[model samples]
Target: MNKIEIIARRILGWKLNRWDRWYDFEKEQFIPVSEFQPEENIEHAMLIVERLKELGFSYKTNGTSGACFGDVCETGETLAQAITNAAYSVADNSSIDEGWL
Candidate 1:
């Protein structure tokens, strides 16, 4: 399977996902927005958000690195949701794409 890891753009508490066949992805409390430097300011974060948007992510904007969209994401929400949304946006392959987890 393809094991991939991308730094997060926001802080996430975590949740259990049992919809598809993908393995469980670890829950990270903090995720870096930029792929380059681990630390980031709002601008760098926005840049990461913009890149993520191009990759399939979306956001309304709240002057933050990552915007809240799905289910409010738990107070601060999750940075992974944006990418997950983008991934699912491509297609609903949850039932088959076991590697998505």
Candidate 2:
């Protein structure tokens, strides 16, 4: 699986269905990634924000399209991308904590 897929499964707790669509454990159904594209969809991107909060991180997005979570920070051309990058950072850190990185 790609990095995003890995993060979606390991960190975001999603599963890949037999049809190659993603199964959201919380939602309990397979959904198209495009419809739930966190990098472009605000509603889905909020999932990352919630996850950050659950991980005990306070975050903020500046007018310059930058997002910061403690020591992990990233900038993107758009707010969604910035949030998505933050998710990736969190997943990477989590992997390190679990000694899988």
Number of the top TM-score candidate: 2
Clashes of each: 2, 0
Q: What is the lDDT of residue 52 in candidate 1?
A: 42
- Model 1, 86: alpha-carbon shift in Å? 12
lDDT of each: 0.33, 0.72
Candidate 2: residue 78 lDDT (0-100): 83
- lDDT tens digits by residue: candidate 1, 3-97: 11232212221132332222223433333222323122344334444544554435563432334333222112333434333333333334434
For model 2, the local distance difference test gives 0.72
Error of 2 at 4 (Å): 2.8
Q: List the residue pairs that clash in candidate 1.
A: 8-31, 8-32
Residue-wise C-alpha lDDT for candidate 2, range 9-57, written one tens digit per residue: 7566777775457887777888775566777776777787887677677
